[model samples]
Target: MIRSTLFFALALTSFSALSQSTLQDSTHIDLQPVSVKVYFAPQSLMSITSSTQVVGPKTLTAQGSQTLVSALNTVPGIRMEERSPGSYRLAMRGSLIRSPFGIRNTKIYVDDFALTDAGGNTYLNLLDPLGIQSIHVLKGPDGSLFGANSGGVIRIQPKGFDALENQVQLQVTGGSYGLFQEQLSVQRKVSDRYQFSFDHSFLRSDGYRENTALNKKTLQTSHQWQVSKIQQLRLFALYTDLKYNTPGGLTLSQYEANPRAARPAAGKIPGAAEQQAGIYNKTLFGGLSNALQLTESLSHHIALYGSYTDFKNPFITNFEKRIERNLGVRTYFSYAKPEAAMPWQMQLGYEGALGWNKIDNYDNLAGVAGKQQAMDNLDNRQWNLFYRAQVELLKNWNLEGSLGLNKNSIHYKQRFPEVNNPTGDIKFDAVWMPRMATSYQLNRLMALRASIAKGYSAPTLAEVRSSNRSINTDLAAERGTNYEIGYKFKTANNRFIADLAAYTYTMKDGIVRALDENGAEFFSNAGEMKQRGLELGTWLTLLEPRNFGFVRELTVQAALAYNHYRFGDYRVANKDYSKNKITAVPDWVNTNVVHLEFPQKLTLHLFHNYTSSLPLDDGNTVFAKKYNVLQAKLNWNTTLTKNTAINLFFGADNIFNEKYSLGNDINAFGGRYFNAAPMRNYYAGVRFDLK
Candidate 1:
């Protein structure tokens, strides 16, 4: 009761301040009138490509999300996985294969930085959510913009300078459950011809699990200059430093005892007296890109980026020591002109990445080093091409299509100090993958889209080329094809937008079973399977613009999906294997949200989500229970002085305290498991933003 009273007191104080705040005149970011219409971008946001969706910063902030998994859960046809602190495993378009390390199937990037595996099954930590301006999720055959590994592509864009403006802002926030975050940003117009901008954020969370902790810091910058009336030059750079603790998985009994508990120390036995015995992991990466615009009718963008990843599990003797580096480049060109049939535009591009990996394995007993085990040195390279054109068929009709081709190569060199194995020396192999898609618009308010494309995932360095004791070289790249159709509609006031889509994905000669027999798992023709689904979504303003309406602003939105899957032809026991239902494909998933704004300074929000039961695996093993979660929050903006303003927030997640998991891997090792979700909790914060 006392805690509640204190909380409300703070809310009331801030509410009063917000009512009298004078900063509203200077607090806007986009420089548009509060009453102006705003619509999310296509190709970047929803169903234009059929099973994909885009999330913008405004939506993110209104949701008041804390983790990537939670932030993305509001989307349809997308599944988010949070196995441990700062680690994620995302499966899209019905993909369910696990790689030797880090995430599998889905490709994740932040400003073109490939957060590949550093140690075992690793990737980049989710950066500060408050600093993000938008995210694009490309589903099925986005290889045209991404690569062939592109079952799905997640892209992020930070805030940037607009057509006009020089603005600077800084914000700091502190909340419950040991949460803290701060962001600083600057955007300056050198002239009508030049602009500069930069953003940085720092965040920390103690987390619900005892050992599930996260710490992250990030920096992003952009520079643009107009060298000629029709030409422009742009430069981009980013840096991230993250450290997190890996909470070893637990058995059902252990979970029942404590869901928010981890191995006393990563991999340490219980009742064994020890200090600071846990697996500590950290990663750092940086990148840069440059783009140039040519004539008004022709523009080309070229980018070069690099990343370095390193990780160690010193506590686990004989565990491989790993280090990797990747360098890549990309170029894109676009042209637009009037034609007899209609106005048309063309786009073409290509990108490549080269990666180097090193791993050292040593023999050891009982956490004590013994003899040298295995050493590996390898290189990985990739290249791809993209082409597309869009044309207006009539005043209200439009057509667009694209094609993409990608190639991947891997090479290995091994030098054992004491032992030598047969299989020759210094070898290499390359694989090629291709894809394509097209769409047609019926009118300015509606469109029809369809796509059929191919994609592939090459064997990672740890899978094909690493000499680590558990490295597997007998595996082949996973191959698959994707198909989809979609429709979209929007309101002229930009207050409402809706989309519907359907898709099917099939994987032939799929790659499965990893690290078995000490990473000696051999590849087979494997099984052919298919996943089919439908997604429906919408964003709308329940209350019209105050300038032309009778009430305050109210926004309501929802996303929903339905899915079905089946495993097709394959050899299970040497003979032709037959029918079986694919597992883990939930029949339904939904997200609904409502937000309200009053005349003075208060915003009220509510959100809800639901997911149906799903099988544990492709074989239709055990089924997980269906579940629902609810969240609500209130934000008050106020000022205590002419120059000082205070913003306060109060929120709760999973208000019903539902217990569920998004991704669980029980067969990982010795009857252990990872959960998909955590229990609910309460949170509140105070924010101070200034010039």
Candidate 2:
């Protein structure tokens, strides 16, 4: 099977090159640098004082990745892992200690709307890359603008809304393990002042392991209206329905015996397959944003958003269901004067959210609900106010400062098993965070920057009222201060670009996850932990398009990360774990991409990813070994007519067929921690566009 797949890829590559060479004339494509827009401010990448990265549409289209992890692995200081077809987890700067199944400690936004809820949980997996135009990532903690996060911030912009043109697109893809997907999109400009777009997608996959199938569908619509010359309104709506089966983790012995088998029944508990454990979720989200120019030097922006979620899960132990509703509002004002002797900018913002949840649990009688076990009602609220100021101190130097106040509170009430009436309310003290940064431009091609910021992360609703049918009212919010310095450089001809950053952070009241004997998950506060890391990214153009024999353009991009994370002070069951390596954090991670473009609109991309060994438990007695994977993709684009185009692509992953675990269950009982990733996979896709 592997040989046949390789042969097919080679044949397609050869055919694309031959056809391109015969059909098109030799023409040079312009290679120019682009500017980055961070926090609604547009500037050159080399001039930005913060550590950030941008992934553009060209890269996304060339790679044709199915998940965000595949497209974002090129960014330094970021890690994404998938346990199953639809389960995703992300970590930044070695902050995965608190995250086990979803995105936490990170703020996420789409356009002007927030994707994170009041309880600090972000549903990033609900978005499909087909509708995304670009992604901007801020590397370290920045609680000045974004609220209550220790990791960082991510902003995603949709395609049609930014293009402002009339177009239609269709795409289809099929790959190994019964993977298939279809997408359709339409955008139209009704008038000079109004624009609208709609997108729909369907995806399904029969995963590598038993009971690991997935089905997902999504619909999204967006509209923009220029009310007047200096006023505008934007609206967005989204709907997603997803279902995915879960294959529980296996012990090392089980993994070696059969990596494809589901978790087996043990003692009084049933097996994962027997219980038909899986997740079913239906969600709807919408937002409205408005911007007004109060004066030549002042502007105001406001956004109102809401979301609803219906979630159902059938597990080995119980059948759980939840109905969740959330509403939020965000407003900000900015004043800028660039014409003055010393340019200055200032901003003030307020953000607030309210959430309500109704949860019910019942006995899982072979995937069917039996007797009612428990019922609960939860209410969560969060609010934050922030202020920022920036000034040009000298011709080549700048200074920035920011401050924020954050408040969080949660209330819980139990309805079932009311005899004892387990009810509680917890409120955290308001926190004040401050940040300062400075940048000095050494000529036009190079810059030096440094920053210090305070960070805070509150426990999620799931962590407080856990799946183990227990409420942890004593859990406290984690606090930390991060220090960082960075250097950025670019050549005058834009042939080379490089960025390097070093940072350290010490956190108190850290949260960690653990599994009980029956495989139930719970969280506890680890006393303290310290993290230090270095990140480096570089892009070099070895050769530009010319009369080169067959290669039109050749470029190489690479990112490297080095992490040193350890427990500063921690103890469990009278045993000290101080100085032990942090769980699930690798010592080193590196990624490289090589791009080669041919004359006939044909391109080839080679990718390499490497990760060092990491500990799986707090005791540091078990570890996951290191692994390396190589992948390649080939793409060809043909302009059939003046207004129509077609694209063909093929790719292969895990070309070496190495067996490794992509995600692990931390501190699991009975040593059932391994979840094996797929060995080797191949995919092919095609796209059609009309204008």
Judging by lDDT against the true structure, name the best candidate: 2
TM-scores, all models, native as reference: 0.81, 0.94
Query: In candidate 1, residue 469 scores what lDDT?
Result: 52
Task: Summarize candidate 1's per-residue lDDT along 646-683 as a digit string, tens digits.
Answer: 77888777787888765565223343444535567666
lDDT per residue (tens digit) for residues 1-691 in model 2? 2332343244334434433443333332222235667655675666567888887765666564567776677888988877778878888775565573477788888887888988777878788778787888887888777888888888888765655668898999999889999988888998988898888999899888888999999999889998998999999999999898888889999999999888889999998899888889899999999999999999999999999999888988999898999999989999999888998889899999999988899999988988999899889999989998888888788888989899999999999987877777889999998889988889888999999999898899888877787778999998999999999876655656778999999988989988888777899999898989999887765555665568877766777888999999899989999999989899888877778989788889887778888999999999987878788999899999999999899989888898988778889899989988888999999988899
Which ten residues in a row are the worst by lDDT in model 1? 31-40
Task: Give lDDT for model 2.
Answer: 0.83
